[model samples]
Target chain A: MAMERHERFSLPKVWKPRNVGEAWSLKRSFGSDAEYVAGGTLLRTWWEGEVAERPAHLIDIRSLPLLAGIRIAEEGGTGIGACTTLAEIRRSCGLAAEYPALPEAVLQIGAYSIRNVGTIGGNVASGIGDALPALLVYDAELLWFDGSEERIAISEWLERPEDCRRDRGKLLMQVRLPDRANAVETPTGGGNAPFSVYRKVGRREAFTPSVATVAISAGRTEDGRLERVRIAAGGGAAVPHRLYAAESLLEGKTPDPDLLPLIHEAVEETFRPKGDVFAGEEYRKRTAANLVAAELWKLSAGRQGKE
Target chain B: MIDNRTELAPAQSRLTLRVNGAACEIAAPPSTRLLQVIREFIGLTGTKRSCEIGRCGACMVLVDGEPVNACLAMAYQVQGAEITTIEGIASGTELHPVQRAFLEEGGFQCGYCTPGMVLSVKALLDRSPDPSDEEVEEALSGNLCRCTGYGGIRRAVRRAIELGR
Candidate 1:
């Protein structure tokens, strides 16, 4: 006869707040006792009864006014509410036209249902795979709210992978992208100038965690020199990081056929990509370099041809 | 030896949600997934649960006019949100435009992925009134249907766009 174990489990207590004030109050009251559930896609998995430990209370922040919608910032950037779902971001024409790369990244996230429930805040909070890399390319800043105070900036909140493991209680509140950073004022005839592109190399076409993801945003001066370039890669290291050496190399130089090899070399030196089940380290490193080169080539060609 | 003597508490919780414009409450654990609540408790079997993780789009439903996977959403999260299931697609006797398109275009055969696919299209059309082919493909990419091969589904979305216009 098999021994029977009567395992009993209780779900965490839920508190749904209708407004931002209510959400803040709950956050203050619960302190570290609660975790905010926006889309609940990630939270559900974390507490799926498989985990031995889980939060005791869930504060549903979907209805919170502070964490909703997409608004244009005064500085000519986009302010995405933490609770705004990927589906909503993809559907907005204002955002689509203004920040094409954002919608492009949003369209490729999980599936229709996951996009519906997964909020930008949840994506940033998780700091996993393609989300951070894509935002990092736009020089995005994360806004965070602890129980007592709110702070901003990408550098301030981002954990160095080691730090993320040590602590908890920091909640990502919003992500802001400056409009002028990658905005193309004059259109090259072929279409609008390609300012940014997010590339993900995965096993399958859709709904696959990226083996390696690269995001690049750059601008070309009217005088034909590279004005600014931002590059970031993830899924191969402890944490996604800016390819500073690679960006520095491309800053003043025009991307020509000869420069492509140099760009590739610079990217390879900047990060030591590691292997996982999805791909080998060699493959990820090579592809990350190739992706950055390809994006640079495309942006340069768009500006040079002006077609 | 691991100690198993920790007394676990019994489950007690009631989740009230509006399903297809009707208020229904059920006694379930707080951790119960909305997918389970819909299919098991309310007995609305239209939503399919595949990959229980949020990767597969089989368990999609519209919550407050937005399409989301039921598998990843907790039942308690739907307290005040309006949920539309696959069963709610038809209006009394008339078929929804997407449903009609799917049938006419042979959008499904095994039909396991049909509910999610149709709901996704509904959400897309609700937002875009008229979307390009690329837009349609992007919208439906989340729902996986190995049966119809997606070519037919793509055609159905095109047809629905025409009909909707």
Candidate 2:
């Protein structure tokens, strides 16, 4: 690890753009020599060690109004600006109560101080961030801007993240989480919403990168059958991704003691986690499978009690 | 005014910020970490620098009344913001409640991690006046102590709550 003090790197000229268009235009003008920075928790760390190639121009996007608000749509969905701090998202009472996985995931990213400065947009664009799995399970959509604004599903972006960078000057505008009320509720008037759970097993209790993380948003149908089940897993050495194979197999299936084991096995097969210094590849895959089973089992048990 | 100039311009600029309760101005490169500015430029050494990376909270300081890793923050980013370093914690001869609590509860043996721990506790109590033991642990999660096994530290946090009352 490169451990030079902060001043070692010959500092780049910093540009504080006032708006999105201006920021984008600056990025275009600087071409490959300029990099957009929001919180700088991740980028600065990489830049210190020369992991992230140093740019001649550091475009500070912190001042841009285009990336600074968390607005709730009239329909109960949320439109979170890219620069909204992780601390804000972790403490959002409405988001916690409605979409539990988001806050749960955000809370596990780093320590309190890092959360205070780290932004959700920076997390998403980090490519292998802890929040990506939870966002995938929530079916979150991202707003992107090159010259014009466009919205794309997070799941699609996960498959080909490089596609978003085609423009070379693309900016992540915001993340949109659809209204949870739209998710089909229990048919028997149980008044319970879909169960969403996020579990992250790390090397230690807190402030450690996850060894394996799992997020599930699922619920039972009128006949006590599981449907609309979405599962995503990432963390540790693994590339954050949606578990499509497991999701397809579990859909419309009745929750039972046997079913969880099957889902666990399927996840083990689907989840291809890479190994790092913290854990081995086999350990990550096993932990991912175990978390998938345990979370599903708990969710299913809670549903049975409500029924 | 979109100045599409891509060339490398002047890296150093005038940065003005409120430190503790005083307004201050300094010229520095935009990449200068707030930790470096506070220690080297302002000459206040209370905030210790350990792991320059974000992993350790030894360089924690309050920016806008919230606990932040000074090492991770650039001087240019904190322009016009209120910053509180360890040196700013006490009010003259009268020690802050958290500081008094740490002394009374014997919160330090080595004293290297004390400043960061105290700042974390201050940030927590400012937000949640009476935090539970779990909340205390969560609040101080970033600040690590090699000695004391955190028993004394935990007591200090609880005592700080009472002292505040």
lDDT of 2 by residue, B1-165 (tens): 355454434345788998989998988677778988898889989998888777778888999989899888987789889999988989898999999999999999989888888899999999999998778877888898988778999889989999888
- Give me the runs in candidate 2 sitting further than 4 Å from their true place: A1-9, A74-76, A164-167, A182-191, B1-3, B6-12
Candidate 2, chain B, TM-score (2 decimals):
0.93
Residue-level lDDT of model 1, residues A8-41, one tens digit each, is 2545777665655455556565666667788867
**Lowest-sum lDDT 10-residue window in model 1 chain A:** A1-10
lDDT of 2 at A29: 85
* TM-score of every candidate's chain A: 0.85, 0.90
Model 2 Cα lDDT, one tens digit per residue, A130-230 = 99888988889999887789889998887885763523778898999988764543333233456677899998999998899999886656676667778
* CAPRI level of candidate 2: medium
Cand. 1 Cα-lDDT: 0.73
What DockQ score does model 1 reach against the true complex? 0.31
How do the predictions measure up, each by TM-score? 0.83, 0.93
**Interface RMSD, one decimal, each candidate:** 10.5, 3.2
How much is B70 displaced in model 2, in angstroms? 0.5
Best by TM-score: 2
